[model samples]
Target: MTTQHLQNRVDPWGQLRTVASRGTRMGNRGILHNDANQVVRPWKHKRWVTCMLEFKQIKRPKPFSRGNYSELFFLDEATAFAAGHRPCGDCQKARHLDFKEKWLAANVDAQLRSAISMDDVDKVLHAERCVPGGGKTTFAATLGELPKGTMFEFAEAAFLVSAAGYLPWSFDGYGPAKRIDGATAVTVLTPASIVRAFEQGFVALVHASAGLDDPAAVASAQKNPS
Candidate 1:
């Protein structure tokens, strides 16, 4: 029998899967060691973080080795943000700074803007990512009101709302764009604060299927201006 590895792909909802694509980076909560290389615990702490694949010439750890954190992968930063993770300060300093700057500037309230720390942001994200029972926390919004890179649920499926259009999200990749001009209120899966960051012009890198390069699609998106 093949031994399952603890390394797995993480979706926007924080669910783990044994998909083929591991993306470009590795993420972790904390050390999750066991005999079977399975994620025995949901997470070790609230400080979930994403790190660069190569950092300070550090060597890759043995996959699912004893006394190491469970490895998680994401398609990109957008996917990581959607999954309620922040950039690692050590390995991803530039991204961490950028994220912090935007996160601070997006908060209009003086007290919140000035007093927040990475831990505080993680706390808020933790609450937004999971519910009391065991699912993601979601809110309702119209398609036009949501910014690009926001993920939402409609008709029992998840979609990534980009400038071009809504792209269906799956474990493999994003599907073709679907126009949502007639869409009413839908359940937004991305956390409210992160959505506000996108609204403030902090762009997240989306998958190629977002159709960001097509001129006609860009024009259509500009006309709609979501």
Candidate 2:
């Protein structure tokens, strides 16, 4: 047999689509599909950290993708589901858009059947995005930028909160709840830059009071420093 024969016998790993190391299995039934092979493909997922399914309608698809890089792949639907890749909007745009619209419709239907309020639906959406700042980044200069706060304090706060998985949301209560800006409401919240500011301030307060030989003065300074 020629080299071609050996190559033919081997599976084409080249055809495999690239994806992130981590992925969560979507429980939506539409994610499973069969084509007479008894195999099923999951509906949709992300190509990377950013892209998310936004506005959509069932009748037409407008998938969000990054063009050719967002190529769709699946030896079959089952394998595609197994590998956990979803239709890309920019590349595989149509299919993904269709999936979103259908998902929203089904979600609304299920909620109605259960007599859940639209508010409940909003909560579900909120939980899904895992927003720490009311789903609006004050830092957004572009579509995908991080959210910043009025004091730029929120931005610093978010950098740490995002690492910890605790979105503290903004305090504005009007525009958007920013995790960073919200935390700053303490008047002395932690930030990457100011993580030790309060602690150091306390120590300085203590030292100054010790010089003055007055514990009461130290405590006062610690509580309300000039």
Least well predicted 10-residue stretch by lDDT in candidate 2: 4-13
TM-score of each: 0.84, 0.20
- lDDT per residue for candidate 2 within 1-226, as digits (tens), equals 3211101000011112223211111112122223321212322222311122122432322111122122222122111221222234453355455434443454545555446533343344333322342222122212112222111223343211232222332211112233333323322121111112112221111112112222222222222100
Model 1 ranges off by over 4 Å: 1-7, 211-226
In candidate 1, what residue range of length 10 has the lowest lDDT sum?
Answer: 217-226
lDDT of 2 at 110: 51
Highest lDDT against the true fold, candidate? 1
Residue-level lDDT for 112 in candidate 1: 64
Error of 2 at 74 (Å): 2.7
lDDT score at residue 6, model 2, on the 0-100 scale:
8
Our model 1 lands, by Cα RMSD against the true structure, at: 7.3
